[model samples]
Target: MTDLCPRFEGAMGIISKRWVGLILFELLDGTKRFSEMESDLPISGRLLSDRLKMLEKEGIVERHIYSEFPVRIEYSLSEKGTALEPVIQEIQNWANDWVTPENAQKD
Candidate 1:
């Protein structure tokens, strides 16, 4: 027997981490500095650093360094990462429908 599901399992594995979704969501707005991400997300600095590294390795996020007094670093979504927007949106829509405040309160 063959598994019917397409093996998006690899891509799923990459984005399924706790902080990864918010990281991608933030990048959708535009590029952001490491400090900006750290401050915006609820994650610890070390965890954010690790997740950013992992996203970079997966080709979903690109990191750039600016030549300045303090040498700032920024992260933005790559082409592949931008492609995830629709998928994320659909997930949000589905959750909105099935996990409404009323529904949650009832449960």
Candidate 2:
């Protein structure tokens, strides 16, 4: 066998987690407050927070703080994160074509 590419391996390790892809997809829509993301995804706040922190640490997500009355915080994709859009979209297309709920049920 040939040697594996570390760069590809690293990226897949980050994005292949259970909720990471959905988090990235949601962020692609635009910046979202923590509450908004929590409401949209079926994940728990703690897990979501952890995932966000991980993504933030990886430079894939940016956190913005607003010193408003409630001290609002929002998340959006960084340039590095935005670069994954086409990859996500392609995966979505492949899933749509081959991984419907009906097919999943059969599996």
Candidate 3:
């Protein structure tokens, strides 16, 4: 029998990391600066940077740098990342239907 689980496991390993799903979801709308992501997420800057680097390496995110007196950088989802919108939406729907502060507290 073909061992198909590794392929699925590999994909899950990346998305299952803390902050990765949320970061991807945040970028789904459009480009955003590092500061904007930081502001939107409760994650620390270092952790955010690490996750962004991982996402970029995986071709799920792209980083752009601007030429200016004060250099600026922006991050956006790549084509591969944009492809995850439906998956993200379904997860959001599931969360809305099941997960909640009340449910969480009971766990």
Q: Evaluated with lDDT, which candidate comes out highest?
A: 2
Candidate number of the best TM-score = 2
Q: Rank the candidates by TM-score, best first.
A: 2, 3, 1
The sequence of per-residue lDDT tens digits that candidate 3 reaches over residues 11-45 is 99999998998899899989999999999998999
Question: What TM-score against the true fold does each predicted structure earn?
Answer: 0.86, 0.94, 0.90
lDDT to native, each model? 0.87, 0.95, 0.93
Model 1, 1-107: lDDT tens digits are 96645557777778788779889988999999999988988889999999999999989999999899899899999998999999888877897878967665331
* Model 1: per-residue Cα lDDT at residue 52: 94
* Model 1 stretches with alpha carbons more than 4 Å out: 4-6, 101-107
Q: Over all chains combined, what TM-score does candidate 3 have?
A: 0.90
Preferred candidate (TM-score higher): 1 or 2? 2
lDDT string for model 2 (1-107, tens) is: 98779998888899998799999999999999999999999899999999999999999999999999999999999999999999999999999899978675331
